[model samples]
Target chain A: MQDARIRLFSFVSLSIATFLSVPGAVLSLGWLLLSPGTLRETMKSAAFWVILLFVTIIATATQMSGNDGLSYFIRTGVIILLGFSVYREWHPGEYLDLSVWLFGKKAGFDIGLAVEMSIQGLHEASREFARIRSALSLKGLQPGIRLIPAVGFLMIHTRLMRARDQADLLATRGYRAGGSCCPVFRTSNRDITMGILAILVVFLSFMPVRDIFILQM
Target chain B: MKLSLSAVEWNAGSWKFRADETFTPGVHLVSGRVGSGKTTLALLSARLLQPDAGAVEYEDIRSRTLSFQYPEYHITGSTLHEEAESYGVNPSAACARAGLAGRWDEDPFRLSRGELKLFQLSCLFMRQWDLLILDEPFSALDCRGKLAVCRSIGENRSGIVLVSTHEQHILPKTDYLWEMRTGKLTFRGPLPEAITAWESAPGPVRMLREQGVIPANLTRDDILEAVCRMHE
Candidate 1:
């Protein structure tokens, strides 16, 4: 049961981080691709794009091959919505108010476990970074630390450690800073179909449907 | 295209680095006080760490890779084999060379410090890079490891090796000896030339020489021979 609990959390967290990163990556690469260049310059620019496309192909192949296509989309939608919420509402601040809005402006910190874990992910990532930096400093090798590797190392340690200790937290039912709760996994074929239909609604909302409504008005 | 690094480079903190002469890569020893920017200077050359001032030039063609000191920092994969794969390093005999053959699938982070260092060292050795900036690779190694690194650094490998280390005990007979002092680095010629000049100096002036000025390559016996008249 303990092992199961850890695996569950690990799977959820890994899926969430991966899902969040896709669009972040896509947007970052999109701007890079939109560089001003001639036809020859564009071909040379295609080198970096090739690297991007290679990674995308790998990710897509894995996602499609896996049977959890709807779950993947749901995970992806949650991330995209969170990303937009950070960008649009805050405009420039970015995720500054996500913590406040995470609980939907009413309940305590642990409203839904996914929302709680999302915030904890950022906190854990930062805390692990500080811990690693402190540990390295104690060793006296005060070289400049690279951000990505430092974060990556700490992240792996943090997740693994949390995965192990998470079961104990559930047993105790204590409210820790890294508050634990069950993930809201609402999956149904009907919901998946509706989700796809919702996407189509938004897509169609941009075109003929709106024009037709305007003509009737 | 010979790019000479002039002036000093400082960033992020109070640390500063200065090079006395131009650097062409071969075997250049950057010796300095513990707090001085020996590592910073090395990182600068590697292009791993940027400088607020001063510039490292390629003259003609550009460099592609920058090696680091702590092998553990460079380990990116979950397992030893995966770590090797991350760098695209294919050791001829990975297991024997890195001593990680048996532990390929095991977590690299769980390995002992020495084992981790060896794994990283093997990966760097297998690669064909133009600039290898190793920041004190001798930190956690025995005498044999030091010799292996020195041999690799001093070899005719085409690219320049900028070794940022205070451990001068196990270095090969280097072509150039560089020292960092008071935010200024002086590039002394060869060990032979520096020892020769110091030997010819008067007793009082000779006493002024810090121990760092004379490297291990120029033994006292060699200096004494240079000082004394020994003609055939």
Candidate 2:
């Protein structure tokens, strides 16, 4: 579809997902409004409502709502839940982190926001480690595989996410319509790029980042 | 650094692949008839699909790489670069590799199928793997893109490159060949040995056998080139 439609659809769907996530949202929906889509689509998209119900429960059940940024907390919470719902419904079985709120606030940029959150997660991990390392030290844990993975998750999480998007964009460029690749490598610009890419590959191979920054989930 | 070790084991439906086939450290072409286990083989090697009763000896393969036939399957990020970064690839570089040289920050779910494939393909090739398994790597490639892929593999294709294809049109420079029938892996010696079989292959190979002037056995490319030459 058009870009506008796609963005609008995603935004509205995300917004509704956020609203529905509050504990009272579903109850409110039961007594309030319905989206324009068919009943099936609405039912399929119960994440927002679910989040609303959850928020209602948390607000009523606990005094946390009176803490701070209740609306902000709920908004960020809803967005995170909505993003998660989109991911769950889309791929069904893939594992990923809920990076929606890891980075404070994002205006509109998608990839940018994800990157920011990954870095934030890394920072948070560092803080968490410093805060809890002494406790673990007394427990006789030797800060081995666990320490590296805690930092690595954020890196792997962001990088692989970026790669997947690149794969999707190849489709828009009109590839594989009549099958892909030719037997012999045709000498062209991509070949030149292939050479440069070779150097980069060599660099990546020598790096020990795989052990340090890994995608655990 | 390496893929986890597991073997293929199964006794189900129309699919079958041998266990502990021992994928070597280079590109391998596993080809056979239509009913052969090409896609199933790729999945087995990549650890994306589990075998009936075998172990996948995946060694040292962290989550830096992603395995997906359909790009839609690998999408876990809310946006495009987010997806690439999830696989531990540079978002900008991944987008460029997928032919999305411009749309660096779009949602991965928003891109078309072809675009998604390119992005996934690049992300796949971006990292050095213990093994890179492709069922049909060239099923969705343009001439230039395919050539780029060929050259990329030629230069940087490290570890095991396990592939299965019937199309033969776009073939990798293979050192070994494995033929699967029913569920057994009919291990051929090398590409040359497989070429001998293809050259003298009974029903279909016979046609290209007569036309075989080139050394390569598979006629997908030669035949197409010949046909195009004849048309010209």
- The number of the candidate with the highest TM-score is 1
**Tens digit per residue, CA lDDT, model 1, B115-200:** 77777766676765566666777778777777666666656346666666667355544666677665666665665465444323
The 10-residue segment of model 1 chain A with minimum total lDDT is A87-96
TM-score of each model, in listed order:
0.47, 0.45
**Candidate 1: misplaced stretches above 4 Å?**
A1-151, A154-217, B1-3, B11-15, B195-232
| Model 2 chain B weakest 10-residue run by lDDT | B61-70
Give the poorly placed runs of model 2, Cα more than 4 Å off: A1-217, B1-8, B13-16, B33-35, B48-50, B58-66, B199-207, B212-214, B217-232
Candidate 2 residue-wise lDDT, B62-150, digit = tens = 42222344445455456677767766789988887777886877877567666777777787788776666665565566766666666
Q: Report the C-alpha lDDT of model 1 over A85-170, residue by residue, as the tens digit.
A: 22221211122223333444334233444444556665566545544443343223353654466447746765776766775776
Chain A TM per candidate, in order of listing = 0.28, 0.25
* Interface RMSD list for the candidates: 8.8, 15.0
How far residue A95's Cα lies from its native spot in candidate 2, in Å, is: 36
Query: Model 1: how far is B144 from its true place, Å?
Result: 1.7
